[model samples]
Target: MKYMSICIISFFNLIFFSISLFIMSLYFIMNEYVIFLEWEVVSLNSLSIVMTFLFDWMSLMFMSFVLLISSLVIYYSKEYMSGDLNINRFIMLVLMFVLSMMLLIISPNLISILLGWDGLGLISYCLVIYFNNVKSYNAGMLTALMNRIGDVALLLAIAWMLNYGSWNYYYYLDYMKNDNNMMLIGGLVMLAAMTKSAQIPFSSWLPAAMAAPTPVSALVHSSTLVTAGIYLLIRFNLLLVNTWMSQLLLLISGLTMFMSGLGANFEFDLKKIIALSTLSQLGLMMMILSMGYYKLAFFHLLTHALFKALLFMCAGMIIHNMNNFQDLRLMGGLSIYMPLTSSCFNIANLALCGMPFLAGFYSKDLILEIASLSVLNMFIYYLFYFSTGLTVCYSFRLVYYSMTGELNCSSLNVLNNEGWIMLKGMLGLMFMSIIGGSMLSWLIFLTPPMICLPSLMKFMTLLVCVIGGLIGYFISKISLFFINKSLNNYMTSLFVGSMWFMPYISTYGLINYSLKIGMNTFKNFDQGWIEFIGSQNLYNKLVNFSKFNNVVMNNNLKIYLLIFILWIMILMMFLMFL
Candidate 1:
């Protein structure tokens, strides 16, 4: 316990250091001169790959928030993980994750960025499987493999960068504007980002990763792992701004947001609901980014990190008190028993739903307003708003089931108010969640975006929230059987409840298709054609030659005499020619 307390204090020191550095970096931000620290690793005749670190307002500001949240999480985990024997290991893993994120934040060189990127994937896998349970193992494998796809894509992008003679992308983004190689690099980079960020096709891993401890979830889902992709895209936005791939990213990101939002409404597990919410928010970040609003996307990333981390920590408290049960059906009236944790949870949820003046409003509401103003296709228009409404829909439903309904846990279960460390963590973030958006908005946006839209478009967010609230209320209040009996509702429920079958498609569908293709190739090409022409055909020819030799030898003296006479005649002819 003493060691844990000391560890928490050390993290506070990191927070202080980051804050001071951010203030110092502000001057450089104004001058727009990026600070670069470099050391030569190797210099071959014409090609040199050097270690490089980039410092700018964006990296510093984002790093500051990441440090603050990570410090709070470390403090919170002291109480949350106190019962575990390997608490020190957990804390160290969390620290390693923070370090990896910092490295990623400061790297301008694709080569250096890979170190950080791979560190994130490797450390996250360790943290995810920390529990040593079957569920944790499976989740970790899924998480690692999914992230590995991104890692490979990033490596390919780095290979493409060799054409530019430098791995430092900051120097080449503008120069390589219309180059085809750059286009391929941009596409690969987006694919990498999509995987790390859990966008669409790679979305299943984020939710499955909830098998890790809650504190890890709070950190990974909220800030570190998922945000890594958004950070990369923020850096690469200049190159991707006008590409068709950006448009495709816009489509996929919109679908991801809508799909996750719908899935959250049907999810019963409390942690999973929160995980899906993270996915939804990630989609929001990616969608805004695809539109080239990198700064705004980054703004949301920071604010979302605050509230989502707080939300997960609050859920940790609930799960702790409930004997580790995560089902919303087994939880209710927790507010009566643990008022502080409940309040924090509600605040985080409200913030997530974009309650005015909360952390999410500054970013999420602005994102919606911007989307509405953009001259997008009708499908994207509807998706943007519908996803926004679904956020409220699931949030309200979760609140009703977990916080306000009749007591659902076992009579023996006693909700304790003993999470001093946990509450301390939540208090800091709760305060931030309430004010982070407004504070960041002032700091980052010199002048808020000016949108002159019709009154209907302006108030669309409010109207959707209200309608979503009412629908969410009715759905939660009504009996499950009544809702399930209807055939249409049943179908819709199955579709939405299963995340539109994304998990099955990504996990089973991809594996099945890949295996099928591999098997067909092996059978038709490697086994059939290659075997017939190379190995099998060569073996048959060798066997026929051996049989002919054996038959000639078996013809005894006659064959030998004929061969000798022919050889003698050939020898005499060669001598005469010589």
Candidate 2:
């Protein structure tokens, strides 16, 4: 059985590798060709729409990230879910989702993009409910509902484009370059992006999505599905540049970043904490997208995929070994029992916390630099800087609380090795998370290489991360001081004590008012004059009304019959005269 699983996993990896190579080769070829050829539409049909595939540097970079993370996830899932009853079904869904996402990445038209967009949503919902538990089912449904809202926006935008303007991609592209209505389309697209990316109000579904299997959470939420919205915005950057929609995106993105970070602090479930972190990081990516630096956003997405997946997988390993306990309070000093897992977790956390020389530092620092240099409002730049502090706080808290505290589990079942297959997958990602940024710099068409950060700024960012981590460590220690007296009192007052009672109060008030109105109306209707007429002996009243109605209808029928006969006579005389 183990050998069979290994063979199956290896086959999938081979297939993905071949496809990735094909995509990269095509990207290079088309990128050169697009510069010389006139933009042309190839086909337009109900089933599919294919355009002259243009490969800019940004698209190439995104495609590469998608391919890399997707391949790693598939490899990891085989071991992680090996003994599951529906492993084959799970793998099939993962493959289908990956194919659809790849199609979305390269899709040229709005319709093709939506096809891929909804495909990701569908597969993700399936994966979230893979466990067949009620919680998983409910979470999947919530995610589907939220994503459907975004899907509707995209659908409406497509309809508007087709009916009001042109249905073809090239036509729309031409129109966007010169049309005044670009703002309307841009706004609609931004709404669609916000929902898919899980920004602000739409973000509530993502945290609940932690009910999914950790691999699903790691792959879909951390890497691909959540990034699709940012991909859409970047794909249509030219249309969104220098618009009010861009400013709105920046504002919402900043708010989401801060709010999700704060929410992570309150969460005790390990997966949910990571889920919130994904949301926060995605918000930051959206903010970077708003700055019109698609490359930087893509860079952040790629680096995040490596580290975040590692974190989730490590969390999964820890939970799986512990019989699926997810609370951080139950996990303490895992570093001694699971050294490799703990080490991998810390490395990924270091990357996530933006430690110097790690992959996250390179990408995150680029975003901060871009934000600082942005021609937009200065407040946004400062907001981005402030959010970094929160990012560090939550990220380090996850690491410290899980790995640094005293070992609390009794009679630990210490496995000599966590499964080699799973370890291999983690090691692959850990390698990438360490050096993926420099490699990405070489792959893309950017100046001075991405690794070449200004020394002073790099030092300051590193200092911020260290300071944030230390502060977070101390705060977690003193958290118990507030946990018992003040924390409980505060939560009780804020939620359970005051505003929590409002629903019952409101319901009672509504019922009471409704009864009062009903009683008054009933009293008015029961007034003696109308009641006296209605209360006349029922049998006699019915008989009299029936007789009156019958007499009136009979008289009317006779009169109509006479008039018809007279009209017929007149017509006959007139015909004879003629």
Candidate 3:
């Protein structure tokens, strides 16, 4: 019964998705764009607080896609989490996430955006800790606190924006585009976006967030939470273009793509591999956006959502059949047992590799073509294409390990294609993965991206694809005996395999040092100096003063008798003098 209700909600959302998409398309074609719906809520002497919703092709199309993916995830979860005792609560949280994302999509006001931003963080934490285990709790805390840093950054941006006298950032993005203060605002927004999108120092929480149910992983990593940052930057791209911050962003995002790709290659957890891939794609989006290709970045963002969500769902199915085992080393010969799921996985993986005519192809290829044509230095240029190759390299490695290799598990696996409900959910995305890029390219862009490059430059993607495939294939098959026997194996393997020590730096390095400082402060200040000077010393002084007063009072009777005798003698002397 709870399942049916969730399905009904999903079906309802699908209708809304279709209608919203249609309206967005019509609005785009008519070119009568940008509807602002506002209602005054409060008024001060000269200030007004109003509720505002911005409707345009960007927001509408994005919201529609979010709803579509969310609905599918809801449907998918029905099967994936059917055995959970708290499925109803889980569905409610998912619904809340959808609502929060929608609020974020429509709001042009910074204050309103906070509602959504914070909702995403809080709800994501709840989702991450839903399993009520130690790992879940730790991962949830890490995810929440890491995101909270971004939340704080955004609040700072909002405070800085008060210099403009309003929270409506849409109005100020253009007006304050060139102001230095605006640069600060943009910087803060970028910091916020970076944390949310898992760039650099903030990237660890993303893979850790995989502790959540795979449905949440699908929705959060793919379209909702991670994309929130990219989407924010896309909205603010006008202010960011040509700024030093944007250049800095380009550098950081490029490195992120490279690092995440390298990390994915070294990762063994199946879901973590996919999560790292999502991180790499996010970096790609941010990199392009930093280069001022806002439309292309947004286009890729939408296309990525389709294939990535499907990829996570595919991973979920495999994990489910494996009885919660998510290690790629233990997952082999899965294709023989679960052909349909494997096919879906392969298709998603290919799309992720940016194969021609697939969803990732249209946007990714255009971005590459644009990157190649840009007036960039050799470092950025090489990083861009090399990361592209790394993407395919890790992808093929993942494919070979899980699908084409020997059955490496310790026990016999009976993988079945019986999750009809989950399969149904995947089918929708599969169709989208095949056609979403082309469809989005047509609707989002007025003209196809013009590419004029040498044949070698044009074929660079294909060349890398081939090279990566061969390398991945051979590397997967090769024995690591020589490397294992080397003295440096532990150090080298630890660095690469542990995401370059990010988990350690984020958790132990940062947390331990902070705790150490806190303990020192507690022992020396709160328990030592403050106790001596403020509490213990003051109490001792009061006790000593009371004891002195008591002794003086006890001697009062003797003092009074002596005073009476002295007064009588003084009166007699005065009479004799008179």
What is the C-alpha lDDT profile of model 3 across 422-459, one tens digit per residue? 99999999999999999888887787768899999999
Candidate 3: residue pairs that collide: none
User: On a 0 to 1 TM-score scale, where does candidate 1 land against the true structure?
Assistant: 0.87
Per-residue accuracy of model 2 over 93-186 as CA lDDT, tens digit each = 8778877887787666787788889999999899889888998897898889789988998888787776544444544654564465555666
Against the correct fold, how does model 3 do in TM-score?
A: 0.88
Q: What's the CA RMSD of model 2 in angstroms?
A: 10.7
Poorly placed runs, candidate 2 (over 4 Å): 2-57, 163-171, 375-378, 410-416, 449-459, 488-578
lDDT measured at residue 99 in model 2 versus the true structure, 0 to 100: 79
lDDT of 1 by residue, 183-263 (tens): 899889899999999998889899999988999999998889899999999999987786798899999999999999988
The best candidate in terms of lDDT: 3
lDDT of each: 0.88, 0.74, 0.89
Q: lDDT of candidate 3?
A: 0.89
Where model 3 places Cα greater than 4 Å from the true spot, the runs are 30-32, 42-48, 410-412, 479-493, 517-578
